[model samples]
Target: FKLSLLQIAEVQTQTYLEWKEVHPPQLPKDAVPVFDKKSKQTLYVARLEDCTPCFYDSAKKSCSVSTFHGEFNLGHTVQNRKISFLLNKDNFEIFEWKKSSFGEVPPLPVETCNGYFIARNDFGLGYITDNSLITIGAKKQDTTENEVLTLNHDIKGQHLTITEYQIGSAKASENIAELKHFTASNKNCEAAKQQVKLDQGIDKTVSFLKTRTHTFGGTGETSVSGKVPLIISIGGKLGLKYDYSRLNSKTTSTVEKSLHSVSMEVQVPANHACSIVINSNTFTADVPFTGQLTRVYNNGEARRTLTDGIYSHQEVAEIQALVNPCTPLVDKKRC
Candidate 1:
């Protein structure tokens, strides 16, 4: 049997009694009326909400709202058999509901949660609290594939956890590999510039290094383990904020092989605006003023400022080229 637009609401004990008093029992078509065992009165069932019809169960002696299209009984709960429904056929499919060992309803599918998500490949973790989400561990999936596996755990009966995994897509894997290569190239460039600085002891070498190594969309990769838990927190009225940290990464291209660290902090006010500050130091080269940049976004417009104020017009143009490589300096108004 098939039913459309099914909605369920719990009945309060008092409300049920009042409803029983007002509308007495009546025999449904092709079905006999069932009387309450205690009251010995015929029980009446009425459509409380918008639906098709109601059904009287002879054995249970209860009337429940239901719809019928064929021989199957629609919108009625049955023992040992789970009920499922779907709206807008393309988006979802009907699935059976499962209960935990304690007879409680299991957590709903993770896709049903509405919020921003950050994942690496298919597996990721996240924490949600009051309009804010703190994503830790690996990144989350960014595709439409249904092969994701998510494990949820309740910690000490106080917190909710979500862990997701899926087969990595080809494009995603290629992107990750490309990022690693770009990081290696950037490392080599930074090392060459630092050697020039040490050998010549001149600021001119720094200028040349900054210009030659300036590349947009080529940031290095941070080594992150998938075992780290993803924390998600939601439900608040305050502004949104994010803090990301990755430690214990080393350069893959250099002989010295010093540690590489990256951290990012972002703030978005409740008024729907964003401000960001990024700081990093790699290979002992002061590329872009020791790797620091600040930006503010409002109403789809962006304004960026350099933290270190020691650069000529040509140098500023070089930095601006890295920031917005496609837009020429002559056309840019804010930098």
Candidate 2:
């Protein structure tokens, strides 16, 4: 059966727990997170690293085959993981498995046109078998609904990975997309929600879509790292709003682009702090659509300038909502 991203995530989490006792990650100092509104019962914090993302592993459990953009490579060790097997973008072709020295192959190649190469040695050790000659999308997979197939291979070790050879990739891996993680609310605590604004004025922040992680040491200093994490909390549920009047620049639009209210229940990870960040391209009011559950980081330094982007009526309202903890919470939007 095919697995969705969330399903894959569950498997990853289960795998992590099984291995947690064997190899626990030393949480970084700046990896700690702070709550938007501190409370005795429940606090929301962000995380930096995706403890588990989907990747392919060999049947022998020796090495894995993974795709990075148009290029592919063997996710063997940290050193080779960074290098791409297919660097030239112009050569974006795909490959097929004719025959392997390892054993009888599954009919996946017939169903799905392309996937990683696998090689096995006499010792039963498997490495990413090579097929460097083919370009990424050169050959398309069989489009027939029955073309999709799943196979389980026992090469050597006790490890296993579900490889989707020919099926088209999912949208969750798309650029400029939204990713969300929802956790159960803390027991008996009032639910937390907020409206996030995007900083559209700043091209850099929008371009980079910064990724951040906040690590808090036992000390008071909340050491934030990565791009600046855009973290905030609001009194109500999270939603999107627009001001079309300001679309022309001189004045604000009374009619907003189409405000969307998302009534989502958020549940954070246990014993894990969340993170936040502001990429260089992110501007005043642009809210993040991707990786909602992922944590970002903040510098914690006071803003030198109130930021001109915040002067806009729409942005001002969002800002007030974010910093409401300090004051009685006044509505800043005149419209």
Against the true structure, candidate 2 reaches a TM-score of 0.14
Query: Every model's Cα RMSD, please?
Result: 28.1, 27.5
Q: What is the C-alpha lDDT of each candidate?
A: 0.20, 0.20
Error of 1 at 109 (Å): 22
**Count: clashes, candidate 2:** 60
Number of the predicted model whose TM-score against the real structure is largest: 1
Candidate 1 per-residue lDDT, tens place, 1-335, comes to 11011111111111001112112333333221223332344423232322212333445644443222343323443233221111111211112222222212234321212322111112212222222222222222122221211222111111001122221210110000111101101112111211100111112111101111111111222221112111111111122122122221111111111222322222222222222222211111011122122212222322221122111110100000011111122322331
**Per-residue lDDT of model 2, residues 240-303, tens digit only:** 2311111121111122132322232223333222222222211122222221111112322221
What stretches of model 1 exceed 4 Å from their correct place? 1-158, 169-335
TM-scores for the candidates:
0.15, 0.14
